[model samples]
Target: MVAAVTGLGLGLAALGPGLAPGFVLSYDMVFVPDPAFTRMTFGLTGVVPRHVPSDAFVTALAAVIPADVVQKLVLLAVFVMACTSAASLVPSRRLLPRLATGVCYAWNPFVAERLLLGQWALLLGYAALPWVVAAAPRAHEPGGTRRLARALLPAAIGGFAALTVSALTAVTVALATRGERRPRVVRVVVTAGVLSLPWLVPGLLRPAGVPGDGTAVGLFAARADTPFGTLGSLLALGGVWNGETVPRSYGAPVTATIWLLVVVVALAAYWRWGQERRGAVIAAMVGFVVASLGAVSPGGLEAVIDLWPGFAVLRDGQQYVAPLAVVVAVGLGLAADRAAEARWPGVAAAAMAVPVFLLPTLAWGAAGDLRAVQYPDDWARARHIIDGDPAQGDVLVLPWASYRSYSWNHGRRVLDPLPRYLHRRVIVDDAVTVDGTTVAPEDPRAVRLAPAARTGAPPAVTLRDEGVRYVVVDAEPGTIRPSGAATAVLRGADLVVYRIDGAAEATGDQVPVAPVAAAWAVASLFVFWSFVAPRTTLSIPLLGSIKPRDPHRRRTP
Candidate 1:
C-alpha cells in the first residue's frame, strides 16, 4: 500500500497537465531571456546549450511539447507537486508516529513555495530523500557488504535523480551526507562515485564544464559574503527577507499564519525530540543555514575564486537550498515523528503535524496573489511586444520580468538565467553580495552602461552620450525616464520600451556547436542509464525485517 502510494505520487505527478512533475513558475528556459536551453530544445534538437547543466534534459523534454504548452503544463505540475507533497500523509496513517513525517514534507515552506514551480527534478528527488534516510542503517552489521549496498543503492538512485534537477545540489548532498551511517568507507565512496557517474560521464566527454563565456562567474561568486549572525537570515532563507527594501511579497495574513504554524510546530517538535535526534536535527539545520547564506554570501566570492578559479560556477547560492531543503524537511519530519510517538495520543500528534503540510500551499497561493499585483501587466505587455516582432532571431529583454511569461506570449528567444550556447545572448543579471552590494541599476563603472540605463545612478549627462539601443523600465516617470537620443516606441502603465536611433547593434549571438555525434550519443545513453535504470539489483528479501520498537522509542526526555 505504501509503495503503491509512492508510485502513485510519481505517476500521477508525471501524468499531470505538462507531463512533467516539477515546480511551476513563469521562468521559461527558452524564448524570453536568451535562447540558452529554451531555444536549443525548441528550435533544433541537434544542438544543445553548453553552459546550463540540465540543457539536454530540459531540451529533450521540452522538444516533445511546444514551449507555450510546456509552460502551462509546468504550472499544473507545480500545483500537483504541492497537492501531492502536502497530501502524502495518508498511507502512514497506521504508523501514527511516522504520520507527522509526511507533514514535515508537505508543509515545508521551501518545498511548497519554491519547489512547486521552480526546479522540478529536485522536487521529485527530494520526495525520495526521507525514505532513503529512514532506510539507512543506524549502526554497522555483520552483513556489511549487503547492508552497505542496501544503503547506497537507494542513495545512488536518489542522488542521480537530484542531479537531473540541479547537479550542484546532487554533488553537495552526496558529499555532505557521505559516511553518515556505518562508515563502510569504501562503500560510501563507491556509492557517491556511482551516484555522480550519470553527470560525470557526460561532463568528462564535454569540452567544458558548464557553458557561458565565463563572465557570469563574477556574479555567481559574489553570493558568499552575507553576514552570519542576524535576525534577517530567516526571511532571506527563502529570498524574501527584504521587506523594507524590496517590499514584502509572497505573504498573506492566512498564509502567514500557516507559515507561523509550521515554524512553531518545528520549534515544538525540536523541543520535544531534541533529546534523541539532536545530532541529525543540528546537521540538517547547519546545511539549511549554510546553503541559504551561501546564496547571498559576499564572502564566498574570494573563497570561490580561490577554490574554483576560472570556472563560472557557484553563481547560484539559492541552488544550494534545493537539497538542503530536503535534509531539513527530513530532520523536521523525524523530529515530528519522535514527538508523536511519545505519550501524546496519535490523533493529537497528527493534529500537530497537519499544519506543516498546509502552510506551503497557503503561503505560495498568497505569494502568487501578491506577485499578481506587482507584475500582473508586465507579463501580458511583454508578451505583446515579443509577439509584435515575428522574427525568429533573438530579442533582448530589459528588467527581466519572468522569462516564462514572455515566452508564453511571444515565441521569440530570450537570454534568461540560463545562457544558451546556440543563441549566445549577453545577460546583465549579476549577483547580490552578502553586504547587499550588487551592480547598481546604473553604475557607471560597468563598461556596458549607457545614460538611459544609468538613470538609477547619479544624473550624468555623459551617460546619455553612450550608445544604448533599447531601454525597458518598470519604474515611474521622472525616476529613470528616457530623454535625448531615445524614443519611446511602446508604453504600458509602468513598462516602457524605447529605441535608440543611432546606437550600434549589440554583437551577434554565439551559439555552441553541438558535440561530436559519438559523444552526444554516449552522453544521452549515460543519462538514460543513470536516471532510468539506476538500480540493477534488488535485495533478495525485497523488504527489510520489521523491527518493532517500543511505542515510546527514546531513552531521553
Candidate 2:
C-alpha cells in the first residue's frame, strides 16, 4: 500500500494529473523573468530581436512550441519528477541509506529548484538518473545475447535522451555510475557519445568569444578574488572550488554533518560486511565525496585548479549535493542490509544523519521572512509601465537585470545596461567601464574605475545623449540607486519616465503586457481540467508496466 501510494504520489508530482497536489507556488512564480530561463526561452522560441547573434539550436527548439504548449510541457515535467520522487520511497532497504536518499531526494534546494522552480529539461535529466545507476551485468543463459540487447537498449536510449536534455546531470550520472563493468561501461560510453553528437558538433564549431578560450576560468578568478565571507554566501564555493588564488574551504555545517554520517556508515560497512561488498561502498563513498566537493570544495588550492580545466563546467557546486545524497542513500542501504549484528547501529547512525541534512534547509528558511507566494504583480506593473508607450524605444535596463542578479524579469528586447544576448541598445554597455575601460566590446578586459564609481555611476551619458525615451529602475532597494543626474532628470520621483527628444519612431522595443494574460489563460485551463475533466480518472501507460525488459533478473545472482 505504501509503495502504491508513493508511486502514485511520485507520478502526480512528476508526471502530473492523478496522485497528489503538485508544487504550488515555487518556480512557476519566480522563473518567467529569470535571466537564464528568459534567455533560453527567447532563443528557443525564435523571438530574437533585430541583429542579435543566436544559436541555431536554441531558435529551432523554441520555434516549434507555442506558449500554451510550453506551459503543458512544464506541467508534464513536474508530474514526472513527482512520480520519480514518490517511487524513490518504495525501495526501502535500511534506515541510513533510506533516510539519506529520502532527505536528499525530498529537499536539496538545487533539485527542488529545478524540479519545482524552473528549467524543465534539467528535471527530465534528473528523473532518468535512477535507471543509470540500476544498470547491471547481464544475466548469463542460452539466448543471453537477445536478453542483454533488449535490456540494455532501452536504458541506453533513456540515458542518451537524459544527456541531451540536461548535460550536467548526465555528466553526474556518467561519473557516478562508472566501473560497474568494463565492457558494459564502454558500451554506455559509446552510446552516450553518439547520442551527444548534435551538441558536441555545434560546440566544437562555434566561434570563440572575446578574451580567448579560457574566458570561463578568467570569470571564475575575478569573482573568486572577493573576500571569503562575501563569496561564501554568494557562490557557496566553500564546498567545490579550490584555486591558488582563492582560499580552500569545506562544506556548510549541514553538508559537513551529512558527510560525517556517510563516512561513519561506510566505516561500519567495512568493519561488519566483509571486504567483497567493500568495492560498492568505496565506489559510492568516492562519488559522494567528489559530488559534495562540486557543491562546496572540500580541498582548497588543488581542487580549484582542477575545476578550471573542465570541472567548473558544473557552475553550481551545490548541485553535487543532490547526487551525493543519492549515492550515500544507496550505499548505506546496501550497508544496512549487509551489517552483521546490530540493528541499533544502523538506527543510531541514521538518527545522527537527519539533523545534519535539515540544518541547511532550516538556515535558508531562517535567513529571512520567506513569503510562500512571490507576487508577479510587481513584474506586471514594471512591464505595464514600459509598455505604456509602445512608440518609445528608450527603455533602460535595470542593473540587476543586466548583471544576472535575478531571473528573467525584463523582456528579450529591452535595452539593458548589462551585457546580454538581447542585443538591445544600452547607455552603459557591460563592456564599458564607469571611467571608460572596455571589457568585452573593447580590448582591455578590465574596468579601471574606483570601486564606488564602478558600482554607482552610469556607464556613460550615452543613454541621455542617445535619445533614450524611457529609463527603468528596478524597485529592489539599495542595489541600483539612481545617480544625482538621474534624480534631477527624474524630478525627484522614485521612477522617472524620460522622453528622449527626436528619437526615431521606436518600433519593437516595448515589454508585452501579455504575461498576466498568458498566465491567467494557463490557470484557467488547469482549473477547468481540475474541476470539469479531472485527470484522476485518466490512465497513461507506465514504461515499466508496458514491458518488462529485465525478465532475466531472476537469474542474475
Candidate 3:
C-alpha cells in the first residue's frame, strides 16, 4: 500500500514527459564540482557559519553520480520524500486519507512556487520536516534512557535538513513537550546543536554582522502580493516572495476556494478532535503567525536578524509555512478519516482531488518550464583545456555577473555556472548582498576583479598578482570585448579562452583549509552514522539480533 501511494505520488509530480533525464529544473539546483568547497566554505564560513548537511550530502553524491544525473535525482528524491513523509504522518488506518495527505502537501502552491524560485535547499529542508516531526519525542513519554536517544535521533536528522527548519523544529518540540519530557527536549536541542558543528561552529567562529532592512521584510513576507488575497494564499500554503513565480492560473478565485476548503476542514477537525489535538492546533497557529511575518514581522524577525548571530540566513519568513503545511496535511488526513467513519467516503475522496484541480498549473515540470537541457559542447572543450593545465591557477570567467542570464539555460535565473563547469579554480565575481548587508564574494580579489569583468577589461597585472592564469569569456555578443593583454588560446561558438601572460610565475595565498573544517567533517560523519546506525542494525543479518526499540512506542502512565 505504501509502495503504491509512493509510486502514485511520484507519477503525479512528474506529470510532464519533459521531467526526465538531462532535464534540469532551475539554476540554483545546478550541481557543480568543487573538491575544495565544503559546506562551511559554501556557506561563507569566514563570514558566517551555517550547518548545511544538504550541501555535504549533494557534494558527496556528486562524487559518485554524474553531476547532471545527481541534479535530476535530487529533485526526484525531494518530490518522493515530500509525498511519503506527509503520508507517513497521517496516522490513519484508511489508505485514502494517507494518500490525500500526501497529494495535498506534495502538490500545493508552496511546493510549486519554491520549486520555480529554485529554492531546492529550502524545499529539501521542507521535505524533511514531516520526518523530523515523526521522530520527535512525544509529550509525557516515559523510559528516560531510551527516550533520550529517540529525541536525539530527530535532532541529528534535522541538523542535516537545513538549519533554519531544524531550529524551528526544535522550538516546536520544546513547545509541544511538558513535564518530564521537557528535559528530553533540551537533550534533543543540544544533540542537534552538537551535531550541527560542521556549519554551526564556523558560523559561531566567524559571524556575519550583516544588518537587516525593512525592504527585505516586505519582500520575503508570506502574504502573496496579489489583488484581494488575504490569508487565502498563505492557507493554500503558497505566498512565495517572488510573486512572478506564482502561476497566473492560480489566481484569486482558485486561492479563495482552497482557503475556504482548508478553513472548513480545519474547523471540522478542531470540533471533532478538540483538546485531544491541542498541541497540533497550537503548532499550526504559531507556524501561521510566524510565516505571516516575513520581513515586517512584529515579532522582531528583522530585529532578530540584526541582533542575533546566524539569524540573517533566515530572511525568507514565508518558509515558516512549511511546518503549517505539515499540520494542514495531517489535519486533512484526520478529517478524511472522520468523514470516512461518518459514511462520507465519497466526499473525503473528492477532497483528495482539491490540490490537483486547484493547482493544475503546478503539474508537469511547473507548467513545462523546468525541463533540463544539455550544456554546450564548448563547455566540455573549455573544461578539457582547463583540466590539461598543470598549474591549475585560478581561471576568471567573464561577462562578470554573479547571476547569469543564460540563453541556453531556458532563460531561468541561475548562479554563474562557470565555477561548477571548470576543472581548475575559477574566479567569477558573484558577490551577493541582502538589502544592504554583504553576504559573500567580498574577497579582495573578487572585489578588484568585479569592475574589470563588467567592462570586459582584464586587470592583467592584478590577475597575475592574484595568481589567476587563464580567463574564459563567455562569447556573449556585446557583453565581453577582448582585453589587450588577453591572448586568445581557444575560441569557439560559445566560449573564448585566454592565457594570461606571466600568470604562471604569479603567486598568492593558496585557499586555506580551516582546522575546524576537518573537525566538523569528522563530527558530521559521526552524527550521520548515529542517525542511521540503529536502522542498519535492524536490517543487516549479523546485527539483526540487536532488536532495536520501536521509536514510536508510547509510555504508559
Most accurate candidate by lDDT: 3
Model 1 clashing-pair count: 36
lDDT-better candidate, 2 vs 3: 3
Clashes of each: 36, 33, 5
Better of 1 and 2 by lDDT: 1
Pick by TM-score: 1 or 2, better one: 1
lDDT of 2 by residue, 229-318 (tens): 323322221222222212112234555455455545644543464333233333444443544442244244235545453343333333
Model 1 CA lDDT for position 193:
49
lDDT per model vs. reference = 0.38, 0.34, 0.61
Superior by TM-score: candidate 1 or candidate 3: 3
Q: Which parts of model 1 are misplaced by more than 4 Å?
A: 1-69, 72-99, 112-289, 292-301, 306-328, 331-343, 346-364, 367-394, 398-436, 440-511, 516-521, 531-557
lDDT digits (tens) for residues 240-312 of candidate 1:
2222111123344455455445555555654464443343334344445544443445455446545553233
Best by TM-score: 3
lDDT of 3 by residue, 354-456 (tens): 7777777777777777776767778778788777877646788887766665677778767666765665656776565434543445334565567667677
